[model samples]
Target: MNAHPQPAEDGANAEHATPSGPPPARLLRLPEVINRVGLRRSAIYQRMSEGRFPKSRSLGPKCTVWVEEEIDAWIRGIADRGG
Candidate 1:
């Protein structure tokens, strides 16, 4: 070990440094999306089937996530339309 020890990393943002401009959008798990939009699992699936919600992306054989920006856009649209 070096004589000078580096400070402990801030766990809150240990993944990456703060970004300039708009922060990069990340993939959100189903529960994360539900929590953000306050929708039930079945409702999200129903809306997606009706082509009114963002589609989930397959990450692997059994994993999927939604683009956070897409969900945010959906919410913004609802607000814009006074709904």
Candidate 2:
């Protein structure tokens, strides 16, 4: 072995494997969001239009997702207000 350790080119090192930063935000598909929020697809979109729901992030021309944390926070807010 060389006296000086070289950095991993493939990023397969143990330190890189376990990130010390905050966990990545999870993306939730429309169906999953509807199921979790107990709203129909139309209702979800309607709320989105009215600025009452968390806006979705478009992944591409046909794909969209919402941040799981935002949805969870929405649910919590509703519960706090007894909605």
Task: Provide the lDDT at 7 for model 1.
Answer: 47
Q: Show the lowest summed lDDT stretch of 10 residues, model 1.
A: 6-15
lDDT of 2: 0.91
Predicted model with the maximum lDDT: 2
Task: Tell me the TM-score of each prediction against the true structure.
Answer: 0.71, 0.77
Put down candidate 1 lDDT per residue, 1-83, tens digits, no spaces: 76644443654443455655887779999999999999999999999999999999999988989999999999999999999
Q: Candidate 2: TM-score?
A: 0.77
lDDT, candidate 2, at 43: 95
What residue pairs are clashing in model 1? none
Task: Give per-residue CA lDDT, model 2, range 45-69, as digits (tens).
Answer: 9999999999999999999999999
Q: List runs of model 1 lying over 4 Å from the truth.
A: 1-22
Per-residue lDDT value at 50 in model 1: 99
Residue pairs of candidate 2 with colliding backbone atoms: none
